[model samples]
Target chain A: MKLLVVRHAIAADPVEGQRDSARPLTSAGKRKFEGVVRGLKRLDVKLDLLLHSPLLRAVETADLMNALVEGETRVTSLLARAPSKALIEALDEPSVALVGHEPYVSELVAWLVTGERQLARGFPFKKGGVAWLEGEPVPGQMTLASMLTPAQLRAIGRKK
Target chain B: MRPAHRELEPASDAVEVDCSAVRIALQEHVARARDAEDSRAVHGLRVACARLDVFLRLGRRRALRDDLRWLRRSASNLRDLDVLLESSAAGELDAQTVSSLSTERTAARAAFLEVLASERCEALLDALANVPSVSAQRARAPLERLAERVRRRGEQLLDAPAEFERHHALRRALRRLRYAREWLGMDCTAIRALQDSLGALNDALVRETWISRVERPASSALASATSDSSSLVQSLSAGALHAWRATRREILELPA
Candidate 1:
């Protein structure tokens, strides 16, 4: 199985929203996410499942990617928090893309591949950055396949 | 109640010791009961086990071993019946659908109550009530043993090879870690983060499994059936994984 973990793009500050969950993606976030979609295409990556948090920023991110990838997209309550047992139980896919908030996305990546609570070093996932893990989904066994930032994708695009 | 035990220090120590022992025993029973297949028995056992575990760790009261053991056994017995009924309800047979299952479930619960009310069980409960209290210091060995058993079982499950098995195992480990954190009066924030990653991995597994096993095959079959008439169906069927990935974006857009 291949797991694509994406942190949601930059979002509006929670000040004007009733809750942080309601905050929408920033313009920069939208642009960055579009860049991410373009990058995935350039990389020739295909997804089987696209999952996102219920948050507006995550939903928008998933929407943009769904437009690009040919797969199923689902919004799940499990992605809403950093420590979601329900989300873990809900996994039954082979190639999945998850878009959610930080501390959670980073922490989840660390936990799945290491069975430890620390974040992976040097993996500074910016808005619209994508990290990929390939291999079996056993805890502490998945290998980091690749990670691409919007900047990297743009650079590659420029080269092509 | 009439005459107070004048030595506060001894009483305090006694309470601490008993509480520790009960807590250990309670957790042990809870783990065992979860493995049981009966829902009612499992529920009762889990509840009592949790109560005793919490009581010892949080309530700081020591109850007799006989009392704890009786609770465990009774809970286990109830759980067995519960599991049988639940499993029966979950069977693929036509009679096991939700509505039919409810009736069987109700009968199972009543039968369990009747079993509990029998003479032999009541006698066992009476014997349980007569257990003598021990010093707090006497509980160390049993507590350590129970903790070791839990740790070993948890490790084994977490180390399973299959993705589905590993997912469940990791979840169990997370739960145990959470329980341990609560018991030790520690923060659970880090453990919670680990759980989230595990969740994401599991989600990926599901999508991957569905595409490979179901959607892709079904799409291919449909494409083959229509291939003679149209080229579009063949093209549509060729990239099942890609198509599934595309649909995922829509699915993820739904309200969580």
Candidate 2:
């Protein structure tokens, strides 16, 4: 099985006293992440399903990908935090995309590749970055196949 | 082993020891408050002041405490009014009373803006930019001290949740603790949850107090207002008490 772990794109600056969960992606953010998605398509990336955090920013990010990937989208609190063992165990899709926030996304990548969740070992994803891994659906079983930043994705996306 | 909510909380970015970032944040909050049209801006301003107050305290900027206090106080009445108006039963109050409260709110907001525009306010924001830079390592000693006080106060508050004053004291203590944690780039959702529950309880209590002061004898409208506010007070107290019992130790004992 293969997994594409994506960090959310740049969201709007949080208005003072606004709910963090309600801050959506800015128009520019949407445009930028769309390019990233196009780039992923160019890279032959595909997904059967996309899981995202319930937070507004991540949800919007997932929506952009779903528009093109035509994948089923699901919300999980697990993506908002550390990935649970159950999350990996329950996965049925051959190609699933997990969209979420920082550190946690990186932590998941670290745990999957190294069988340990270490900040120092984690692959920090830039905003809109995606790390592609392939392996059995268990901790330390996955291998990092590819990683792409927003700029690289956008650049690749711009190609014919 | 990091807890789930710990991961959800925004881990502070690499905290630069500089005070300018904080000062700029506070100034932006103040600017928003100056033209605010909603409760959010008022709340944002209040939280900003409280956060900066803790920063000043941590850096031993004792002389500026009064300015911070004054800035916070200027908004207190308006904030209270905003909370009251936002309450569900605020509509139940007699039209005259509601009108009177609205007028008071308007005046209070004017006063608050006037204070914000004052020379003193400018000085306070200016002073913020110049607070002696505190090394992250150096902030630990005082933060640890505050943590002890918060734990002690949490114990007292849990013992006497009904004591009106203890609620205020513990709320302040928890807020200070949370801000200190933010400065050091740590967040405990438990602390944030506790503070929010306490604030809800406090808002309910303040609504009760506001009505009692303005209540008119034989006024059916006032009577309805009191009933709704009393209900809120009871429900919120139960929620706050329950939250305190559950998270008190976890949040209070969190090391600085």
Q: Please count the clashing residue pairs in each candidate, in the order shown.
A: 50, 0
**Residue B173 lDDT (model 2):** 89
The DockQ of each candidate is 0.01, 0.01
Please list, in the order the candidates appear, how each scores on TM-score for chain B only.
Answer: 0.38, 0.84
Q: Pick the candidate with the highest TM-score.
A: 2
Cα lDDT, all candidates? 0.51, 0.75
Summarize candidate 1's per-residue lDDT along B1-256 as a digit string, tens digits. Answer: 0111223353233433222343343344444434443454346445444434333323222222233344455554334434433443233223323344355445555554554444333332322222223343454343344445434544454455333454445444454444433333334564455455554444334323322332222344334423422443223222322332333223222233
**Candidate number of the best lDDT:** 2
DockQ of 2: 0.01
The residue-by-residue lDDT of candidate 2 on A57-141, one tens digit each, is 7766876886445555555666766777866764678888888888888888888888888742459888899999998878888
Candidate 1 chain A, which ten residues in sequence have the lowest lDDT sum?
A83-92
Error of 1 at B12 (Å): 78
Per-candidate TM-score against the hidden true structure: 0.38, 0.55
Each candidate's interface RMSD (Å, one decimal) is 25.7, 21.5
Score chain A of model 1 by TM-score against the reference chain A: 0.88
